[model samples]
Target: MTTRTPDAEPLLTPAEVATMFRVDPKTVTRWAKAGKLTSIRTLGGHRRYREAEVRALLKGVPSIGGDM
Candidate 1:
């Protein structure tokens, strides 16, 4: 989507995403680095993910603009 409003899409932490994928948190970070997941950075450089995208992935759907 071209316009993603912050309030409309909920955010997920790396741990939360890992839990959904049954992977480790570090693996989730690796996925982000590999461009498999779309990440939003916090001021402190922590990553956040879109809940919808995460759910889509859990259901075997590809991310909106991601590698997987």
Candidate 2:
């Protein structure tokens, strides 16, 4: 099946991702560092995750780039 990519995906904070994964916020940061999750940096140096990617992980689906 072909999947369509959204032009503008919603970004999520570490805490928000943590809640979705039922993990600690620090664990979320570690996942970013280890490349388990992809993170985007803000101008203020905060990390943001793509909501679609995170949801895909929760559902055990591979992301677009197939990192997982």
- Cα error, candidate 1, residue 8 (Å): 3.3
Report RMSD for candidate 2. Answer: 7.3
Residue-level lDDT of model 2, residues 1-68, one tens digit each, is 53548876788999999999898999999988888899999878999999988998999997644553
**Residue 35 error, candidate 2, Å:** 0.5
lDDT of each: 0.85, 0.87
Q: Which runs in model 1 stand beyond 4 Å of their true positions? A: 1-6, 64-68
Q: In candidate 1, what residue range of length 10 has the lowest lDDT sum?
A: 59-68
TM-score of each: 0.79, 0.80
C-alpha lDDT of residue 39 in model 1 = 96
Predictions: Cα RMSD each: 5.4, 7.3
The C-alpha local distance difference test score for the whole of candidate 2 amounts to 0.87
